[model samples]
Target: MSELRFEDVTVRYGTGRRAMKAVDGVSLTVPTGQVVGLVGESGSGKSTLARAAVGLAPIAAGRVLLDGRDVRHRPARGSGRAVQMVFQDPYACLDPRMSVGDSVAEAIPRTGTAARRAEVTRLFGLVGLDAAHISSRPSELSGGQCQRVALARALAARPQIVVADEITSALDVSVQGTVLNLVRDLQQQTRLGMLFISHNLAVVRYVSDIIAVMYLGRIVECGPAHEVLTDPQHPYTRELLAAAPHRDGYAANSAHEESGAVLDTEPPDPHHLPAGCRFHPRCPVGPLALPARTDCLSLDPAVGAVGRRHATACHFAAPLPTPSHQAT
Candidate 1:
């Protein structure tokens, strides 16, 4: 069975006149012992979905299943121990006054004093922290160390799955690598399931077994990490990858330099979303002209079948005629 599953889940905020569905008819299955990357721009409902999966956000419709049981109906309180969250900001997550040891130990309560002490020491070691750092406060540690402490706290409950929401975005590049490696190592050691949410497609490619792309509260594409990254079928997916910073040098007359290309349009406000595909407004290439692209703004764009290990929500899933930005 999948570790966690969202069956046609919908989370609507507000009521009556202003009710808005942050996650609209979204369904996903995260298998055990694998990392699933949820990639999208801000306000794409990634974090909202993450919160609902972990019981932090309430679901307005559909079932949030854990091992095939509805968590919303059953209220998986103790079962939450098996599914924990490592938030994006570690410093804000931790208490300034509490000792790092106390914070980590708070996840799992132990009976005997000796056993508790040993558990704390083991967890510290597990997250690559010095045992001596246990007594220190949050202010005493660097951003990376604090994040490690956060990971240790999440694992303290012996969770089978962790929802990591951009955990490395706040850290420096050097420190981000350490934290990413640590999470990967810890996952290998524990064989834990993970739902990793991020905007960075490069980082998503590195760690995800599967990638799910989101646009305006809907999953626009889903596929294997390498396949989706290397050859994206959706226009939004292709645009995202093209815009991503790469290691390779760009030629003078490149896709990025096209004058009329819609690379700089602002994302639509989530409260007042546009019609048709949420990404249509910002989509660089379309069959017709902008603003009133009748064919492009058709009711139901053709989303390819969930075969070939890739599914894309585009009326035209055809390959791009012109080359996208060069691969770094």
Candidate 2:
């Protein structure tokens, strides 16, 4: 079953003349027990989608369904309790003064003393922490331990899904691996679904079964993780892949970050959105016959479904030869 589904969801900030769309017509389905990664650079609406899924962000238009229930029909806090989130910073998320056990035990409502004790202890073990360390505060633990505690709190609620927004970015590389392994172990045991949001493609590749690539405020591409990463169809995905610095691959730098690149134009104002495809302003290739962009100033290209499991939004979705300099 699908744990969550977003249909034409849109989130706008401000009002009247100043209103701007932060998420535009984004639709996605996250199946139960699957880890879906929402990846994009800052201001690309990845975090906005994460917040909307957990009821932290108000939706201006469209529907967000959680386990088949309309989240808007329920209280945001109550609905959120069913779908917990582990923020990017574990230290910031935890109560500095509260004991780790107390913080985790807080998730349960008015349960008996014995039940709460058993629950907290069980959760500690479940997250790879011992029950003896329950008395420790957030300050006493390492970054990885704090993240594990954060996961423990989320697990305490017995949630169906976990919204992990770049949870490992702050930890040391070795520590990050430990926390990630714990997450995978917990997911395997509970079959809990996850929405792993981050800009790091390597981390997403490690944890996600499916990947959804976002642009300014739209999902430009989405598919099975391996399919999307290895056989990217969208120009934006290609750009991201080329920019990612993988261990076994040649290092890459973003075209936008390079000096003297004509494609480094600033994004279009959300209020004054460009017509046709949103990515046309920075697209690097367009040989195939495609859409014309008359309404807006940017040229439009052809976009099509390459296969049943693959789709791209770029007008020139066909594969292009790799650049010579990058082939080292």
Candidate 3:
């Protein structure tokens, strides 16, 4: 299967004085039968990058290539290029008055009522929903069911790649887990390439094969999910894992008991980015830093290989000690 690749892509919105680059020059690859988890704080351009894959976001520079073909030039949906997106809020995309089945059926590119119904039913089954849900309206279903419907709709198109943009962020914690499992199962069964974007690193970790960390429109780190999560090399990535709540009591759920010294500074505006290292101002490794780099403020860091399948865009990238290795 052909992989979906972002080759030094840059996405900008608006023009001139009001212009903002939502996604800076970035590259990512999502191969079939794998899920690439994208995690970062809100407005970090995770969704924008995913949108680019499906031709939803504008590409100011570079290209979103699927199997070596640009999405814009490829077949729209039924032709051959099948890239579908399940949005964050299903309510916004789903017609409230439409029945769940009909919502999904709308995406099925088939002719005649019989063909449509058959295809929709197949999609429903694929997404783990029973035929009973066909007549139920969106308002009558739980958030999890709504999300399933959205996925079913995307599946109806027979997409090779699926962009799930914060699809579970709206559900309850319990429901979120259930939805994530469904997604994982579906991906494995279909061997579909997936771009799973989320702010919750835990959720990403549970579903992704590889993880990419974004910050203010640029990728700061990308690597195997285990390495990026357990032994993040980039400072920003370390900050994210550090800030993530840990179970100090469950395994030991003392999550609330441990403190992570996270920087709380406001991010720079997209329209006016910092001149050098985008993260310089708030970097922990400043003048008081060990292995400090006096040129951090003047030198922009590019993504460099740190290990096998691991890359970080920081000059002083180093892995943080795991909880077991750190002083309690």
Model number with the top lDDT:
3
Ranking by TM-score: 3, 1, 2
Against the hidden reference, what TM-scores do the models get? Answer: 0.87, 0.83, 0.87
* Count: clashes, candidate 1: 3
Tens-digit lDDT string for candidate 3 (143-246): 88889999998888778889999999998888887899999999888898999999988788888999999998988889888766666666677666766666
Q: What is the C-alpha lDDT of each candidate?
A: 0.78, 0.77, 0.80
What would you estimate as the lDDT of candidate 1? 0.78
Q: Candidate 2 lDDT, tens digit per residue, 1-328? A: 3488898899989999998889987888888999998888888898888899888898999998887788667544433266778999999988999999999998865578899999999999999998888999999998899998999998887777888998988999989888878877787888888998889887777788999888888887788987777777776677777777677452332332332232466776768776666766665542211224342234332233333234556644545444577655
Task: Kindly state the number of residue pairs that clash in model 2.
Answer: 2
Q: What is the lDDT of candidate 2?
A: 0.77
Runs in model 1 deviating more than 4 A are 73-80, 247-260, 287-293, 302-309, 318-328
Worst 10 residues of 1 by lDDT: 250-259
In model 3, residue pairs whose N, Cα or C atoms come closer than 3 Å (at least 3 residues apart or on different chains), thus clashing, are 248-252, 248-253, 248-254, 248-255, 249-252, 249-253, 249-254, 250-253
